[model samples]
Every structure is written in structure tokens, then in C-alpha cells.
Target chain A: MEKATEELIKETAKDIFFKQGNLHATTQDIADAAGVNRSLLNYYFRSRDLLFEQVYNEAVQSKRSQLDEALDADLPFREKVERFIDVYLRDMRKYPFKEAFLISEINHKDFVLKNKKKSAKLISFLDEIAAEMKKGTIRTMDPMHFLVNLFSMLSYPIIMSPLYQQLFNLSHTRYENFIDERKDIILQSIFI
Target chain B: MEKATEELIKETAKDIFFKQGNLHATTQDIADAAGVNRSLLNYYFRSRDLLFEQVYNEAVQSKRSQLDEALDADLPFREKVERFIDVYLRDMRKYPFKEAFLISEINHKDFVLKNKKKSAKLISFLDEIAAEMKKGTIRTMDPMHFLVNLFSMLSYPIIMSPLYQQLFNLSHTRYENFIDERKDIILQSIFI
Candidate 1:
């Protein structure tokens, strides 16, 4: 029952946040949305800020870990890049508001910073890619720059979905199709 | 004097919203920070949400129009991409919090459904790009995918600077250097 309530809170809060944003969303709002007592909101998470952080951390960390694992796997760089794109798009679809929420929170004073470390293995994997660039196995470029652009091209769309959906009149199906085609586009943009 | 006061209000509101997420910020707080009467805020802008939309529209439209004009200029695709990166980085440096704030606003329900028609020109540009892609002059890729990744890599660092600064232990000088090199990196990532 504890696990169930926790799950309920997560679902309710996520829905409320994406709909209303963090500022307008009250604890009572979350409690009412979750069909639980307002006190239970505090019981599960001490404050709205804390609750926001919990969701933010969970939403962000899950993607980070998966992408890290994909990058760290003993695969060719090209294969790894493809896997990274897949993992990123899949994750983006799952957590549509995570990018915007986290970006907004980055500048929040009430947002007490959390120690969400990047996986060491991912960093080392990135270093290896840099080494390959230096050795001319991959194109000559800064790995940091490459990584930033690569992920940005893939991830920015989802974060900007509300904007893009407006601009392109993209249906949900078409938007997913757009995401599906990014791996080739990104690779050709880089490895060529 | 009216212009100066309006500018002050905008500047103050930007700082507060940047420092605290929109939920925690109030019009009263913004008015106080600007050293103006609370009534002045509404007098000038009608409401907090409308005032924020003005700020966001200015922020996005400013960079966007400049970039759009550049894209229309008779430059090679590679040079245009480089110019886009340079211009984007420069604007991002000038208005560090603008994109995050705009993105946050875009996610809110009040704006999302209401403002769909206001974004047609931005979508048209992407459509034009996709049309170009079909002619095989540029590499084949979904325009939306290309767009998402490119913007994410280029823009995410700025929007999420506090996180990156902490995690990377990036000094101001180092961050500037990273941005300086980003134009070439972006060109390389996009150009075959």
C-alpha cells in the first residue's frame, strides 16, 4: 500500500507539473489529484520542493543511467552512438517534461542542488571517444562539442515538443517518426 | 521615465524568475524588487503571465529573426550553419536565462493551447529545410530530428549552465572557451 501510494503520488504529480508547472502546483493540488490526504503528500515528500526534486531526480537519473550504460558497453563507436540516440529518444518520449522542468529548476533558488553525479563509466567512455578523435579513427573534433551537438539534436525536439508541435503541426505519430530517424542524421552529420 | 521604469520592471522580473522558478515568484515580489508600486506591474502589463509572455516572446523572437534573416542570406550551407552557431552562442551569452524561461512558459497549459497559431513562421522555416533535404543537396535526414539534436547540443548547456558548471567544475574562462569552439564543432556535427 505504501508502494502503491508512492506510485500514485508520482503519477499525479507528474501530470500536474506538466500541465500547470511547479509554481502553480500546490501540495493540496497534488494530494487531491492523487486521491490521498494532504498530509500524505508531506509524509511521502517533506515539501513540494522536495517532491519536485524527487520526480526530477527519478526522471533525469533513469535516462542518464541508461545512456551511460549504452555508451559504456563494449561496442563500436558508431554502434554506441546509435544506441545512445535510441536510448535518448525512448527516454524523451517517456519523460516529456523532464528536460524543461530540470532546465527551469537549474536556475531556481529554492531548488537546493542535488548531487546527481554523471556516471564515471560514461565519462571514461567519453574520454575514450576523445582519444579516438585524436588518433583520427573518428573525425577530428572535440568530443565534448560532438557529444553536446549530438544529444542536442536528438533531445531538444522533445523538450521543445510543445513548440514544435505548434510549428510543424506534427501529430504524435509523426513526431515519433521524426525521432526515429535521428540516428542516421546525427551519424552522417558527424562521422562523414 | 516610463520606458526606464518598464525596463526596470522587466529586468527585475527576469532576475527573480531566473533565481526562483515561476511558481515561487509573485507579482508582489517582482514589484518590490523593482522598487515600484505593486499596481504599476499590472498597470504596465496587466498580469504576471502576460508580462512573462512578453519577455519570452522578445527573447525567442529576437534571436530567431536574426537567425532567420541569416539563413535567407546567400551563404553556403556550411557557412550558414557556422554563422547560426556563432550568433546563437553570442545571444545565449547575452541573455543567459531567456531560453529556460521561455521553455518553462511553453510547458504551461495556459499558453500551450492558446498560442498555437502564433508560431507559424517558425514552423515554415523547418518545412523549407525539409523541402531542401529532399533535393539531396544536403544529407538526407528528418528535419525535425536534425533540429532537435542540433538545438539540444547547442542550447542545452546554456539553459542548464548551473548544472554543467557544478558538474564539470567549469570556470568562467573555461566555459567561454568551450562556447568559442562550439561554432566549428556544430558545423562539423551538421556538415558532411
Candidate 2:
């Protein structure tokens, strides 16, 4: 029962922060959202800051693992990218504000990644991108820029959806459909 | 003297919120940063929320004008894009957190943009991108995606610099140099 309650509180906090984009949510807010008393919430997490730290660390770990899973898969480079985009977009659709929340935490709170071991998977993926360039399958540039470009296209539109919807005069439903259409557009843009 | 003091408070708030990424800054924080007394700061802005609203509105206005200037220029489409990237990158280098701040304000604060007039300039720019696609100068896709891709490539790296610096194992100076080298790479990626 205790473990279940703890998980419930944490998940509720994540829902508020990642899905709702409420970076300023308080302990009481989490407690209220979770249908628990504030004292019980405190008993589980001790403090709001401590709860946020756990959530932040878990978010980073989950993202790294998602990248690792996609990059380490045994598939052709293009197929790997396609699968990665599918997985990433699905996740973003569920938690559209997760990236924005993570960015804000890092920017405003001086949060630093605790793990520093350079991912062998990411390095190998860069090499793969470079080899694809050599074969003229993709544009030749710094591999880092290639990765940056890929993620920029995938994540930026979702992160800035609110602003773009207004700027483009798109209704919410139309804007969502537009984003749903970008998977192919992104692939064609990347692979010449 | 009074007008100058008011302007100083607003600018100081902008510096703290946009440049420093200190979204939680209090009115006292702004006053101290401006090297003025709290009462003087309040005398001009009345309250922190009011001050933030003024700053936020001005930021949005400035960004719109910047886009209008770039998109309305008489240069060819490619050169116009080049100029937009250059202007945007220069602004981002100076205020790296501005976009992040704006997104956060919109997401968390229920802030609606006061202006609703569809930009004729941006509409025409989209038409230009479509024309370029017909001319085989760029990839053929939804022109909105073209703009999204362009802005995404331009803005995401800067906004997520802290995370990228860690992920790529780059020193600050090296990372900055890498970003500076991306203008040509972005152009190449888009122009085929």
C-alpha cells in the first residue's frame, strides 16, 4: 500500500509537470491532484524540491535510454531513424510538454546532469551518420549538426506548438494534424 | 529622469528574465540588479506582474518585427533565409534564453498574445518557399513545415545549449564555435 501510494504521488507529479506544463506546481497541488493529504505527500517525498529532483533525474534517464534503445537497434540507418522518430513522437504526444519542462528546469534551476559517461551508442551512431554521408545518402556536415538537425525538426514544433498555432492561425485540432504529417516531411528533408 | 528610471527597470527585468533565465526573479531582484531602490522600481512598474506583462508584450512585439523585417526584405528567397538565420543567431547568442522564457510564460501563465492579425508578410514568405520548391531550389513540402524546419534548426540548439553541451561533452568555448559554424551547414541542409 505504501509503495503504491508513493508511485501514485510521483506519477501525479509527472502528469502535472510533464503533461500539464506546470513547473510551479506546489506540494499541495500535487497532493490535491493525487487525492492524497498534504502530510501524506510529505511523508512520501519529504519536500517539494526533493520530489522534483527525483522526477528530473528520472526524465533524463528515460530520455537517454530511449535514445540508446533506438540507436543500438540492429537495423539499417534509415530504418533506425524511422523507428526512433515513431517512438519519440509517440512519447511526445503523450507528454507534449516534457521537453519544455526539462529545459526550463535546467535553465532556471542550475540543474546538472549527474551522469557524465559519454554514451558509446551515441558515438557509434555519429559514425554511422558519417558513413551514410560518405555514401551520399545524407548531407555531409559535422555529425553533431546532423543529430541536432534531426532532433530540432522532431522536437521544436511540438515544444513551440502553442506559439506556432497562433502564429499560423491554426486551430488546435488542425495544428495537431499538421504535426502528425511531419514525420515524412522530416525524413525527406534529412535524406537527399 | 522618471522615464529613464522606468526604462531602466524594464531593461533590467528583461536582462534577468531573458538573458539570465531567471524566471522566478522577484521585484526586489530586479531592483537590486538595476542598482535602484525597491520603491523606485515599484514606483515605475507598480508590481512585478505588471512589469512582467510589459516586458513580455515588448518581447513578442520585438520578435514579430524581427520576423517581418527578415521576411519582407527584397532579397531572393535563399538570401532572405540566410539573412534571417544570421539575424536570429545573433539575437540568440545575446539572449539565449529568450525563446525558452517566452515558451514557459505561455505554457505556464495562460498568456495569450494580444495581436491576432495574420501576418501578410509571413504568408507571402510561405508562397516564396513554395515557389522555390517549384524551382527545384528546395525540397517540396508544406511551406509551414519548411518554416518550422528552418526555425527549428535555428532555435532549438541555442535554447537547449546547456543540455547539448553536456550530452556532446563540449567545453563552452568549443560548443560556441560549433554553433557559429552551423550557419553554412543549415543553408546546405535546406538548399540541397
Number of the top TM-score candidate: 2
**Top model number, DockQ:** 2
Q: State the lDDT of candidate 2 residue by residue for A69-179, as single tens digits.
A: 999899999999999899888888878778777777876645566547569999999999999999999989999999999888998899888789889999889999999
- Strongest candidate by lDDT: 2
Interface RMSD for each of the candidates: 3.7, 1.8
Which portions of model 2 miss their true places by more than 4 Å? Answer: A113-115, B113-115
Candidates' DockQ values? 0.47, 0.66
Q: What is the TM-score of chain B alone in each candidate?
A: 0.74, 0.95
Model 2 residue B142 lDDT score? 93
Model 1: lDDT of residue A94: 72
List clash counts for every candidate, in order: 9, 0
Model 1: lDDT to the true structure: 0.69
lDDT of 2 by residue, B1-192 (tens): 578889988999888888877767778888999999999866787777788789988888888898998888899888899999988988888887787778778866465665475699999888999999999999899999999998999998988887788889888899899899879989998997
